[model samples]
Target: MAQQPRYAQTPTTGGAPAALAPSASSSAATTSTKIGDRAFDKIEKTSAEFFAITYGALVRQMFIDHNERADIVNTQLDQMGERIGVRLIEEYAARSGAPPCRSPAQAADSVAKIGLKMFNPQRPSQWLQPPRSSGPVSSSTGAAIGDAANGSNGGAVYSISFDENPLNVFVELPDALRQTLWYSNVLCGVIRGGLQQVGFVTLVWYVRDVLRGDDVNEIRIQFQGKERETFKVDMQK
Candidate 1:
């Protein structure tokens, strides 16, 4: 018999997200192109399958085959994240004209309008900025964002929050509950793969949040504080 589809249904979970996301809305008055549950289901299944393959390979390549080495696996994941950063910059440049995203809202717009289109064609983007940035949250022109950055008191402190997670399609996976399942920082891989497909290599990709939860799907890439480096997305606003 042919194997069952991945999303025939969600596997039992500790529990599903408190609320599933609402269907997307369109501002254009004439016509709206939207992907419904069926599309989401397909993405969900593909995500789960990919996670399985990547996680298993990671374990074998890192632990059983050589011996558990945390650093090795982590470096791999981060390299992947940087690759994604590079590819995303290219896409943003093409569609959004490469701005450093003056505000959190703009960042969300970049992810939605550019990132989602290139990565998760089936899903829309939803961005939530983490409090404020330790690195001045102002326009490249150096205009202060005012009181909004008032919360910037954190002072170069590390602030952790979610970024654009296309893999949320795997939210609460089945069977894998309890131990659940995670190919930690696998987003790094996706980012790397997507970027390498094009051409860009500044920083290496990496994953910080692990098997955390669907609530905070965080991922990032860095090259030794090179985030300050000039790039297309960093172009003047």
Candidate 2:
């Protein structure tokens, strides 16, 4: 007997077979983009130049306060970003009306498409997988990069790449700070903190930074595990 096709065709009122509707993931992505655009339109505006310069000044002061200890300064920056992220995630939830992310991929999509877009507004972030062992994969910045290894013990790993970083505007790194400092390490902390707030314990770090003369800025994130909540009950005397 002859084999039949995998998907059976269904006829519509017009008598022609109906086309398949969009996939759920595709529809969800469209919805996320629309939500991000609407939220961006409603947020207060700020000058990018001003924001960059102010952040630069703050970083410089941190260098001064920490006696140019790059590691210490980096730690402090990450701490500051974590605090900001803790609050920003709440605002994002309230404004974007986005549903809770049920998986690492969904969380990554929300962060790259919605969260980052809300701040940058003009630039779009690219979610990328690392290169396979067979060959390197092309990235948004036109560089050959590989996909990150899957997180340990069934965790997930992915990268977000950016062609431009507003934080690096009007900023240059001296030779001394090149190797020791990650200028935008705060972004990694922000990702970690924001996801942590929603029950995800993630390990986030910068893999490539334009400030360090890389072709693009890439932040790698790995899902570690879910945050375990502990509550203490008091006994009345």
Candidate 3:
């Protein structure tokens, strides 16, 4: 029997983001109309079934390659993510041309709005991922909108809360490595690595995980410092 689609019955309350008009310089745009349109059009999403298996194999290989050291695996994953981030910024700018974010709150909002839409656009509204930076609040008395919440001191810190991770789709950690493994920790590195290119140095990490039986998955990003000089050099490179 054929399996049901994971997001078939999923609600789509949030409106789709308006496509960023590609500028003349973005050769990638010439190849694909929109950042997500290619994936949306050609590939039949596998309900993440094959993704889980392939990702599981990768983790297993990493374990053998590293001699079963969880710390080394985690660090390796982060470093790999960082390299991806360094390149991702260039692609992101080419596609979106999102201006330099002024504060941590703004950066978090952009990550939730633009980043998710580019990568995980097809997820259901049940995922509670916001369509825009100004998403709905969870409670009537809430102070913030969507998963992007500004901290008490304002721009110094913020959190982007969400329920699903594209990488962690249908993942189940074995009991032997449950406590030691941060299954999706590479994401933290991605955020840190990508943002650093844009001049914002940050501390990014997971606060909760569904793999750990948490109700939600959240990533907290804290402002560290900004380097305009090096940022320009990195962008030029």
Write down the TM-score of every candidate: 0.41, 0.76, 0.64
lDDT, candidate 2, 148-208, per-residue tens: 4565555677777888887777777866777678887788888887888887888787777
lDDT of candidate 3 over 1-237, digit per residue (tens): 211112222233466432232223333322222433433333333434445545556766777788787778878878877887777766666555455566665666566555544545432122122222433334222233234443433435555566656666545666666667777777778888888887887777666666767766666666777777235322332
The 0-to-1 C-alpha lDDT of every candidate, in the order given, reads: 0.37, 0.67, 0.56
Best by lDDT: 2
lDDT by residue for model 1 (78-99), tens: 5655566556555445444434
Output the TM-score of candidate 3. 0.64
Clashing pairs in 1: 78-204, 78-205, 78-206, 79-205, 81-205, 82-204, 82-205, 84-191, 176-180, 177-180
Backbone clash tally (model 1): 10
Query: For candidate 2, what is the TM-score?
Result: 0.76
Q: Which stretches of candidate 2 lie over 4 Å from their true place?
A: 1-29, 131-149, 228-237
Worst 10 residues of 1 by lDDT: 136-145
Better of 2 and 3 by TM-score: 2
What 10-residue stretch in candidate 2 is worst by lDDT? 2-11
Question: Runs in model 1 with CA error above 4 Å?
Answer: 1-25, 28-66, 95-109, 121-210, 213-216, 219-237
Ranking by lDDT: 2, 3, 1
Best by TM-score: 2
Residue 100 local lDDT, model 1: 54
